[model samples]
Target chain A: MPTAVTPSVLTRPDDEPTAAALIAAAVETMAVHGYHGTSVRDVAAAAGTSPAVLYHHFESKQRLLVTLLDRGLDVLIAATEEALDLAGDDPAERLGAVVGAHVGVHLESQRESLIGQSEIRSLEPAGRALVVTKRDVQQRTFERVVRDGVRRTVFTTATPDDTARFVSAACTSVAGWYRPGGPLDGPTVIARYRAIALDAVGYRP
Target chain B: MPTAVTPSVLTRPDDEPTAAALIAAAVETMAVHGYHGTSVRDVAAAAGTSPAVLYHHFESKQRLLVTLLDRGLDVLIAATEEALDLAGDDPAERLGAVVGAHVGVHLESQRESLIGQSEIRSLEPAGRALVVTKRDVQQRTFERVVRDGVRRTVFTTATPDDTARFVSAACTSVAGWYRPGGPLDGPTVIARYRAIALDAVGYRP
Candidate 1:
């Protein structure tokens, strides 16, 4: 179940033109029209290519979708890990770091994050299981932080597992409603959510 | 934008065969196939009726989807209000009551709730605005409670608005994952979430 997609697979290389174009077109179309609404031909047209070219790179539309989702999740995990590394020994600071990173990544990759959240239901059985397993790994990271916080008395939640789920869900949801250049900038939004996340676990600051 | 849908619209009158059948079919289909994946023909066929019959009650497929979502949100709002009424004057108790009712309502009406959350993006412009407006009103309820708690020093969050959004998002996400007859039953799930919610807002005591 640990089919950790390579981070390089997500990044567009100058050498691979078709695959890069196809991924971009898929993310743009699926983010707006949704997975079911966008067909291979629609993506192909958006990419200035043909359906045969799309099938050449990806076997089917489902495969293309799973690839996009896998890449997005991989990027998110990497960002979270980096944030956790920067966070010091304190559990509360670590929790804030995770929230800030979660919100930052989600807003920076708004379209992909939106598609990743909404289109999980569109994946086939096998794809869904793989994505769910990867998602569980990400959730475990948050759970571990919360457990450490509770053990140190820095957090006083009765249900650490539930707290992890709540914080993760809340952080991931920032992408849903947040608009860039709105009332608050990215830094402000991150700061506010970070405080809320710390407070959420009964973090004694 | 204030299309405040009446709560009674969600109830099935038993006498209204067409609308009830249509709603049931839509929920069943959309729950599995998603709003984008489902078509008017699919819903009509599932209901054992023709497209004309569906159109007679609902003007279009988009209209039907919005109607279903509006009713679902209205039901959730009413249930949350009732929970708040029973929670007495304590802000912490009120927060728990809101979370408990939120999880309970989402789990009870799983299909419609799932559709209501995931398919909101598929809504047309006017429909999206109206639904978002209605949703904001619900969020305001949580904000008001959190603000009151902060004023009383029972909650120590600097961002009451962010706390409301975080709690609402976390509670609403239960519908995305909860399965009936799973390892945890409805009451246990609700109770765990209640504790998590209470701790999340820094409720002291």
Candidate 2:
């Protein structure tokens, strides 16, 4: 498989802007123009900073992406776990909360969520493996939800694995066409998605 | 919106293979390597022909894409319409049949469907409009299903439009990951999707 290789070097010191800002800028630019279509210079320009400052923090573009993907996946995994935890031992209520949290992750962390899912392959081999690991972790967590739901007899999907993959694909692809101009706003879209997801997973909302 | 222009010629005059074969080859190549990544040489090679033969059929790579977009949209619209017509006046049953037919379209013509949805923007002005028209038609037909469902007290969502959009996005993106690999065959996937979609749209299946 063809993979990008990472390089590490920076002449600047530790007073640079936070990695968060750089990753945010990279997210917007990468989302609009795609990963390859954007450059380090464009990211700097969009961030309203110099390449020297950017280099001081990230070392390279792929490193910046790695930072973003890690942060986003961290947020995603935590939110799903939190939702499941908060719902207690009840399968039906727990199922709805998990769906809400899944949709909420996309809405709250739209940019990071999108870039992590779609643009991670643009990262170098090491960075890509890191992102994939995080993704697999989340997928397994989702699988656990399905297994739990089935065990509790609250959700009875025809095929647990296929249902899980279908729901994950829909949830992840939200950032592709989602924007401010849509007919539904954040909470409304989340509610709608939660309802549909719950139903598809065989929960009665 | 940069778009590929329509070719001056509809098809070819002394072509033994026919325009349909040429369109299929172009779509296959485009799906494998997005619009910008594919070349006329790659498409011609796939078709078991030469560049001169391609030029006779398509004015340029852009024009060839436009033709494929036009043809893909036509096929989907025709298939869905035929499915609708076959279902008669029962909304829930009609919608189930529609879902089955929708999956059939994906299984039978996944390559064109994939390219048309993911790479249609590569088509020129007129060609883009043609694709959009067909898509809008599909969307409208879906809306009709939702409307009928709501009118008959079948669906409970506040907005049919968002529900339709979410369901459409969910099923269509299946093209990205769905393989001919079957622990679930075409009929099984279609059957599951029909049940899933009907419940999703508020049908009590």
Candidate 3:
């Protein structure tokens, strides 16, 4: 596993300041008030813009949320992919890398990650489907690695699918309780989670 | 561990039909639209009552949510306590029983569980404090069990607190993906989670 792996940074093009501001405001408001609790007006007010300007950028409040959720998933997916690429051929190393990256992303993007976890129900069916599809891609990455490990006799878990799900859920939940300056630092969290994932899978080495 | 272990059931007194209806409606609506997305009017309509009646019962939407969240936590805490009581003195049995009961409650009380997980942030400070206090009790239950297991040398985890947190988070998260009529049934899910939790702690026996 890579020693210096960092979460993929969430950045936008330099030209979209107003849009960026609106997204930032939405993250802040939604983090506090939730999706149904937050309004386009609230996001606009927080962004120092009018509802008309908010509408010009995104068709509706749900659309703005969809945009933000998509971006958050993008960062998570990118980070996981980068970690896996650097993890080499051993299934244990790959599992550690992916779990590390998963924890890293959720820690670095707590609000966005929390929103993504909580507000998927708030989206329209189409938007929900879009986010679920991205989420499934990430899920499949873990599933495939675990299945491979089992096939190779490296992971002794009786239920590969369930083990993968448990590891992902355990890692995903870090966002709910993790504080930025909390006792555990980023690399420490990443490393501990990697150990937990390995143990959960009954890793041989 | 008790062979006939089951999750504690969440039941309300049959006397308060209107209040019960209101609470039930709130659970359903909040499950779909979330705490902030749900409104008193919607819950009232669903319960076949008026906003005044909802107010008479719950005082406000937040109050209704706080009530719901409190009830959910009560059921969870009761289940865990009962499981611990019946689990004998073995730390592995204790861990299995609690994880089993936790998964059982979340599966049977999916809507309430989902709402409780997502809506804690929607509570006022006093209500949030009350709920957090209850939540901490449940968390400490797991922490103490794992710590004891470590002391007894039945669990080989280097970090008992983190392992406990990971196990609880992993079990709590089953509510997010589990479906009643899905591929796995409740007992199967519970059994799988017990094994996963045991493996997570590196159980020696």
Candidate 4:
């Protein structure tokens, strides 16, 4: 139940360098060294700035991590929402879209996805709650699709909730091992995942 | 790829304290602080022993992690093999058994499973290769069942290899979120995963 008791603060607008650049620097440092292994000084050094500059833009090291995680989740949720829209009304197609979108986004932003998934332990209570809440919202989109499919007899699973969980787990794992120029391209991988997701739900045709 | 260039060494057998106790200590420490964040001193403290005692059992910190990971994978492979044996001839049944045993074993040894999955990056080349070979062997078990099911038309998947990967990913993720005394018990969760596995391959029965 530990929470980051500090209120969210805006990055300094008048800084010499943009906050976006600072955030990008933090992401790279964290991605390579892990959250606990990296420090504000390390990030600033990697970013070609000083601790004073970093502190000017962000309240603390904890805040930098929370911001990065929140931004990553935001990007993921937005992309998946768009995919759901394009999927239209068919539950099977919708689920496939969800899988493809999930895999594609994770692979596209592999580092952020890796940090977001792995570093939940590093967050304080409030930051953790915020991230979890956002994650739950993303999970609900998949759950709703599964529930719809089951209700309509279009798809069948013994446990709908766990079904959704498994699908999320499977898709998210692409980030762990997938290489951009490997045997499978983004579309090829997405197609394969779509097949797997559809097959897992007992979808026919 | 960065490989741990050092060759694997045999663990010391004649150490003052048993290797098992030191391993238990290492697993607990790595589980909390992560591989990079932990040191020999930290593990010794957790194990209630001195660094000299730890060094007697494990050659170095890297060696300690590699040993722990190897042991974890060995235990996992053994348990899954037992599950496969109980599953007998039916491909659907075999697949179900794989998922059930996977989730069950992961939940039972959550910490080791977590560390095993996450810290492969920390291993040296020889150690990394050793671990990857063992992991591939474990992966092949699932692949064989899926391929068998597809050949028999008892289960259908467009890409059997990808299907196996997805299933492995999904089942391993149970260790991430499952709580021991949560609403669902071990068997209940396993049964649910069994259904998902069966459905993923389009198993009719």
Candidate 5:
């Protein structure tokens, strides 16, 4: 079950490159095919490598799965942080910009988000808990944005946390149904999603 | 792979006694182990039954999984319908009710919802297509509600489809990290989600 954790430049400092590739591959395959339907070979095939390559990169099939969860969350956090940077001096504009950025990143990494969401349970309990904790941080970040808006009296909301969650969920689920060549591209989706988020939470520009 | 399709029931159709028990058991096992990770034997073991009984009831594992989806959708639809049944014909009231119901069902059946949301790929191509189509229908239903709300001037500004999706994803993801005996129970979660939906969409009561 022991597999290598080979580090790569494309991955986070602690992440192995092969492990990250395996994860990126797993994200594509697992989202398209359920985790159960996918095999170690599928991850290898997608990476233009073999199962030994995957093992050489990670600790075990389970650990590789866990690594993906960890990295996906990391990517999501990084993405969310970037989105938050879009926040401006004005609360509503900041909210809209932030939400747009959030949705933008979601569609940008559609495969990764979809797989992380759908296959989270494939990880061991510890991994599952870690993912949940990271997700909470993401949720809290949204809540903070909404709370700031409310305090400014620019956006009127009864429950900021609930509103934050609505924005979060709507933005995340775009990965599931959005087609690459559809009438709505990622930009359009982000724009529309931002409108929805701002209006839902009553952020007046 | 042969499985029985228990369509009619003497009891309330929503609570399919044996099927509920089976799906409930399957949801827990499937979410963790995954559709591939879980076997009928595992489901039966979790449910305190024999695999023979499961096969006799469901015919095949895939069939059972589909049944779970069918049940979860039924509950979700019913909740939405119930929410739509607001008095005084106020679109805002109806919208809030609908949001509440949507979140309620999602939070209540978090496990089953998660299973259906994640394991959808395990279905045959045709089955998966059917599920996608059904999901679209659900989306359209919410869109119509948003449209009505907008027409009634209950909302400040938003596209119906995007707003509908915003509401939908908000509640749907409650299953992802919602722990039993967590700080927020079903009612609180539903109410909070409802508030979020209302604010996001600009529902004025």
Candidate 6:
């Protein structure tokens, strides 16, 4: 049987230090230069390693990007799941928690969020499928919360799916324009987005 | 006197067909390979022209990108202005119109919208400044309507600016995932977003 590809939110014990270094370098380089503009040599040089070492760890640059995207998604999914766990069964609170976590993650990991959004087109079929599967899980998390809210009559939106997507899209966009020390701090942005998500869903309370 | 740059919604008579062809080619190429990955040679080859001819019209690849970004903004700004004109003075109607036009533009000009959103970072100081100025105008357009709505007590949101930003972000994101022959058509998506924008602002009937 083929080994399963399970993503871990935390740093894995099996992760080689050199491979981790390469992934970090790849994120930074690809964030600036984009996938097509970034070469394996660029990532290897940034990681202070040789192309042979990079190839030893990962088959190619595409594989490196897939790993980066997977790791980013893992972090996001873990954070969201934690938030949902802490929030009680109240649909409004759950919606708030989910949007807050989404905004916080995007703000804290802006580069990774940006790369995940922009570089999906650069991935091959298998890699794209992997990322899309993770993405759908994230999307469905929001949908489930919104649907629950609708079921409980706490949310009044006619289209629960569309509302969930709008909230997700709005939160995802923060990474594109937010600056760490800009006008609004992270907490303020998070709070605002949480409220906006509620408003988008037409929270009755 | 320095020639003041004015952006037009319609193609200008001064627009050389060769230059237009080059810009079209640049959008398609950069959409696929990105700005950093694409060279003047690639754009020239795509346009079926020589690098000498490309340079004759555009001083550099960066200038060509700026022109493309500027033109894209022009089209968006014009479409939005027309929508607002037809919306009358009612805040809710105006909000619906603006978002409808916004989603419509992103759907109709997916390549240009995607390029404009992604390639802003690739621009140099002057080019970035120019695009940012146009973008602020677009942003302020949404802000004004929201502010007006709040003043009239039709929208209950305390943070009109943030609500405006959220609505704009949500609408702008349509370009990233919307497919022509997907489950939802253009009119459906546009109407759904218009309603979502209203819901986001806490619009009152």
Q: Pick the candidate with the highest DockQ.
A: 3
DockQ of 1: 0.67
DockQ of each: 0.67, 0.31, 0.71, 0.61, 0.64, 0.64
Question: Candidate 4, what DockQ?
Answer: 0.61
Candidate 5 segments whose C-alpha is farther than 4 A from its true place: A1-21, B1-21
Q: For candidate 5, write residues A1-205 as lDDT tens digits.
A: 1143222222555555556667667666666676777888987887667999888887566777676667666777776677667556777766766677667666776666767787776666888798789888877888888889988887777777767776787788887777889888777887787777777677755
Over B23-127, each residue of candidate 3 has an lDDT whose tens digit, in order, gives 777777788889877788998888788999989977999888888888889999999999999999999999999999888889888778888888889899999
**TM-score preference between candidates 5 and 6, better one:** 6
> What is the per-residue lDDT of model 5 for residues B144-192, given as tens digits with 9 covering 90 to 100?
8778888888776557767777778777888775787978777777667
Under CAPRI classification, how is model 4 graded?
A: medium
Q: Go through the candidates in order and give the C-alpha RMSD of each one to the true structure.
A: 5.6, 7.2, 5.7, 6.9, 5.2, 5.9
| Model 1 / residue B63 / CA error / Å | 1.3
On the 0 to 100 scale, the lDDT of residue A85 in model 5 is 78
Which residue window of length 10 is worst by lDDT in model 5 chain A? A1-10
Interface RMSD of candidate 5? 1.7
Q: Using alpha carbons, what is the TM-score of model 4?
A: 0.89
* Model 1 regions lying over 4 Å from their true place: A1-10, B1-11
Standalone chain B TM-score for every prediction:
0.91, 0.85, 0.93, 0.90, 0.82, 0.93
Candidate 2 per-residue C-alpha lDDT over B121-173 given as tens digits, one digit per residue, 9 for 90 to 100:
45667877877887788778778887788888877656677667666666676
Q: Against the true structure, candidate 6 has what lDDT?
A: 0.86
- Name the lDDT value of residue A53 in candidate 5: 89
TM-score of chain A of 3: 0.93
Residue B137, candidate 5: C-alpha displacement in angstroms: 3.2
* Fnat of model 3, as a fraction: 0.68
Evaluation by lDDT, superior candidate among 2 and 4? 4
Q: Positional deviation of B199 in candidate 6, in angstroms?
A: 0.8
In model 6, which regions exceed 4 Å deviation?
A1-14, B1-14
Report lDDT (Cα) of residue B158, candidate 2: 61
Residues B1-205 of candidate 1 have per-residue lDDT tens digits of 0112212235566637667777778888888888888999988888788899889989899999998888888888898999998889998888888888888888888777878877888999999998888888889998999899989999877788888888899988888788898888999988988777766677776
Per-residue lDDT of model 4, residues B121-161, tens digit only: 67888999999999998899999999999999987687888
- The fraction of reference A/B contacts recovered in model 6 reads 0.61
Clashing pairs in 5: A3-A58, A3-A59, A4-A57, A6-A16, A199-B200, A200-B199, A200-B200, A200-B201, A201-B199, A201-B200
